[model samples]
Target chain A: MHDSAQDDVTTMTFEAFADTILPGEKRFPGDVTVAGVAVGGGAVASGAVAVLRTDEGGMAPALDNLAEALNGHAGGYAAERGLSLDPAVPPFVALSFADRTELVARLTAPTHPERDIWVSVAMFSTIAFDAAAHLHTVDALADGHPGMTTMGFKPPEADGLWRFPEFSYGRQLARPHPDTTPSGSPA
Target chain B: MTAIESTDVVVVGSGFGGAITAYHLAAGGARVVVLERGPWLTGQDFDQDFKFGSSSTRAFDFTIGDGMSVLAGNCVGGGSVVYFAAMPRAPRFVFERHGSIGRRMWPAAISRDTLEPWYDRVAEALPVTRQDWSDVPYAGGLWAAACHHAGRTANPVPVAIDNERCVNCNWMMSGCRFDAKRSLLLNYLPAAIAHGARIRPLHEAQRLERSDDGGYRLHYTVVDDVDYRVEVGGGAIDAKVVVLAAGAGATPVILQRSADTLGPMPAAVGRYFSGNGERLNTAVIDEDRVREVLGLSRSDGVPYEAYQIGKGPCVATWDRLDGSLPEYLRYSLEQLYFPPGFGTILAQVPDATGPTWFGAEKKELLRHWKSWLTIFTMSEDDNEGVFGPPPPTGNAVRVSQQMLGRGALRYRPTENTLRGWAASDAEVRDILERDGLARVMPWTNDVVGAYTVHPLASCRIGDDPATSALDDRHELRGHPGIFVTDGSAVPGALTVNPAMTIAALAERAVPAIVEAARQRGVAVRYGAPAPDGATAARDAVLPLVAGRAGR
Candidate 1:
């Protein structure tokens, strides 16, 4: 396990990175990780850090390294623009949202040798905000995952399975197969 | 190693190719054992999560190469377990067309007419169903309507699915939890099991060698499905006949590994690869136009409307195989829907109006996420791809034990393929923008180096050993009992999804395999006889071609 202080810096850096990709409102008072540049819930609120920490995300071990690299880029970006980063937060978190976005563009540029790594980081952020990918569909729906809820995803029935007897076209254009049963299985 | 086990036949992989072959051979009364490197995941185990890479339990393996990345399912039912279930047959021209060398890519013995009976057999088992107009999901309907407005037809494809049971969850690629999708697990595999074939999940085949008694010895290891960690237990299985159905991305590696002990493999072990010219594009439908098409009035107080792309089957393809395009340039357009989480990944729309891939504009686009349509295009690409030793520079995943130290795929689109892609892109953009119904966006600016799930023809079948890994009989040249029956054996791009064609080829090869086993003094009983009228239909279509001289 990483030291708590180091972990905090890494978490803040990722939170800021995810925020640049998909911004959201601040979680609560005194929350310094999220930039809160945009309106509705975003990658931070959608559990981007939690998703990244999961074993399935395969990003946990690389978090520290990624944060260091991001901060290095942020420092370079700040130096190139003749702007000083805030001393209170991690280097990446200290930059303005616009600066962060521009730095990310450079990191994800097609010609960059490490483009795939940065792209993967951005993708994980989007996955958290879009699908709550780490959570089970039922559990995510029940918990009202910000992304799923915002997308208006329908919840499953009590049996934990979705069954839509009604057609999306308002009316059925073809009859069900002769072997189809009431439960929808082929008899 | 544990004591060596003996079986009449040992099959690698449990996908469409392996499952079909196992079922036929096991039914024929041959003692069969199937070794699958991935776990046996059922409907209960499936979820909408986009589990990818080697770490995921679903084992969606990714082999990132220099110019192309290949995705293949590493599970019991193989590609069929995770496929979209589209079962369209290859057009006749795929077999008839000649390559740039002026030589026909496919063997003369293998053609649509010859494979019709085998295709029919697979269709009956899976019970392929063509979706009715009512059965078409919203995304498919939108595509059809767009095509109609553009004076083209978007037809519902025949799919290997029980449509009645489908809840339109749009999770077909992730494996259907509803058991609605007719994957090989639902049919061929169960049948194979019932016929007494032993399916050993998490058993990875490492190497192959000839046994002292003229049979083949398959060396394998027990692996943990989650991390693919090789466990302590391992043994060799000796069998009279060995079938390599480990998919296009894998079969070549296995053969390459066996070359030293089994004798030097043919030069064409990993040549003529194809990604099936697969490309993904997106179109954002205009909300007002969407409402107009759905007949919704302005008075309706719905602030944000959903297109319900996630509530239907994965794809409803638009057939563009008309003769307006040259034979090599024929392609099909499929309106695909990824589930919520996975769908947003496609949000990287290359040419969005403002602030592409981030910020307020991207968030706004996410707000209307339901209105986005992902269009997947598949064309008949020139098989210019090759699978060889990993290049020194690129990041390559270790896919097999001894592929001369990790196999890597290198591919670049030929001139014809690029033209086909451009034409298809223009057509899709035109259809989407008909009367300004939607804003079109290319998925990626890098069209030549795109990823594909449909990696094919790595160990293609042909008449010449110099250019083909397997002969027309699906057997490796100079190695009679070793056969490759999978997407690896397909000669060229099928111009449609290759699952059905792969299954059909496996079906066609089974009888020959059984006969050969018998001739080799191995007592093999034939089972799962051809469907009634299949033989007569095949006979009427064309006489069975005699074995060519190359063998």
Candidate 2:
């Protein structure tokens, strides 16, 4: 899928980057529907990415830059590790989950130029994941956003004001806890 | 630039300092206008959802122009909106220290006796209260128990809250949606508004210039958005008297920008910045385990059981520092509470381990988010920071980096302050470990150069014009009509939350401010003066408290 503003190549690269950061066991539940389109709970969280790109433009350029530099990152990692590559240039988006993880770890090493790129990706991915899990309501059970069920995170609602009738609200000076028994004093 | 609006007095903040100043000045019959850089938020604006709540009400959204971060309130009420409603006065010893024989007449010229009346007045208005230990949450009880086990006397910390509305949600940092907190938004501001004080929110004062009319001209831009994008029309306000109450971090920047017009200020203008020796520590105590240690037999006592997180006042401090300092530099402890999501974030990174939120490890931490507790320690700190114009680079990112880089390179914690923090941490560690409550975790960030939410003492008030920014009257040493009434004017570290103290100083500064404006042919009258202006000045000051200039 692609928009006129964003090409298909950049979109796919972003999705791959997000999946590596948050590989949900299941799709997030899609409780939210826009224009009758049920949103959230997908293996590839395009909604999260779109929201993140809209909110934080600082990370948007890195998405495309990372895609363009993926081959360089793979080659440098291979050379540093003294490993030979099966293909001289591997497609990062098409790499297996294990290969992608290895590629990412190397790209984000302290000395690597792509470290900031990975940081931007990780930050956006988490924000998108949280938004999907917390915002959706309708297709929640069927949708596979693992963060919701696994972490037991719930969306906020108007539950009414919290009431503490027992509290005195400092009408008078409060004495210390009666249960406070000094270390050397009698229990 | 739009035409400048003229007024009798223009206060540059709306927190405790500005709010109190505006109320008193307005009551004194002067036309008072207050400019706040942040939004004017209402109770309905605050949310419990972490992201929404923080962005809307809790977060200050300011960086220290360095990598080091600072936490302050960015709403209409300022720090009072987000601070733990605790309102303990500065210890009598602090006032006496400046008046004592060895360092007599060196630091602050004011004494405790002069401030005692204003303290009582402020306490009555805010109506500070000490909570019954039974009313606090599980965290409070745990802190009390730790204090007892450590052989330190634990007393109930006083809070300024509306008992009728407080639910004790423990989300005080996020702003009180219930309007339980007696912040300036609820009290002083509204009173000032009723007395003809006009508050202009989202108006950030960028610089100041001496006016042709001899009053100060405050140049400011309206912040259409918090991110500094999309600016509206900019304007200036010409006031007979200008008071700087933008807190410690920002007040110095305002003054620095105005130096060309206001003439060279004392070298001490940006010097003496401090963090009030603030430090925070935490431990994850299993509810069942802690209860059992306290000899409470629950119906279903199980180890590692999670308890439902509820809200209450966030902090309860102990007055005595125990052995945290060498009989002089005092330390105090306050229990800190966070929103559940903050708890999750805190749990995710135990020791800055890289990315623990991917697989089962994430689930394990999120499951027990309710079991975490944070203990914060604050000690007296030396004034040790400087703020000036961002380098010529004009890049916001680069400026922040340079500020933090320079701050890191220049800052060296004094031996006494270091020993104070070390002693405070040891005391907290002893409390947690002695009872075997839970694992005491190491700090995720550097403890020595840890960033602080409480920064004070940038432009302190003193008798000497050469060494201090302001005179004993809280007026700028060289500039007569300009004044400072916020934490920037605080002479030294109070070693405690400085909200109440700031308000008390504002109360004390109002009389001189009104008199100064009146002398300039500005009739500064309270709503309607009592039979006697001097006596009325003594009573409520209606807002100003006039006192002996120097001790």
The numbered model that scores best in DockQ is 1
Evaluated at residue B22, the lDDT of candidate 1 is 94
Residue B387 error, candidate 2, Å? 2.1
Best by lDDT: 1
Q: What TM-score does candidate 1 get on C-alpha atoms?
A: 0.88
lDDT of each residue in B458-546, candidate 2, tens digit only: 78787766557888778888788999998888777666667777887887777778778887888765333321223433455443332
Tell me the TM-score of each prediction against the true structure.
0.88, 0.78
Clashes of each: 4, 22
In candidate 1, the residue pairs with backbone N, CA or C atoms under 3 Å apart (3 or more residues apart, or in different chains) clash, namely A131-B341, B28-B525, B28-B527, B168-B311
The prediction achieving the highest TM-score against the true structure is: 1
Q: What TM-score does prediction 2 earn?
A: 0.78
DockQ, candidate 2, vs. native dimer: 0.14
Tens digits of per-residue lDDT, candidate 2, A1-187, equal 5454434556655565566655533343531111111122322442446634552234454556666676566566567766665452235554555556667656655455555456445544554444342333223323644444443443333453333333222222223534322211011
| Model 1 C-alpha lDDT per residue in residues B1-551, reported as the tens digit of each score | 35789999999999988998998788777889999977888887786553333123364565656467677777889988777788777766677766544688788898877777777677777867666666766666666666665666556677887877887766666677889888888887887888799999878787799999999999887865554533656788999999999888878878777877899887777778888887767777786775565332222433114355333333333345643556666777877765554335545554555347665567766766666777888887778888776232111344322110123777877888778788888888888877767887655533114667788888889987778888898998888899999998988777677888999899888877887777666666444643322343334323342341111
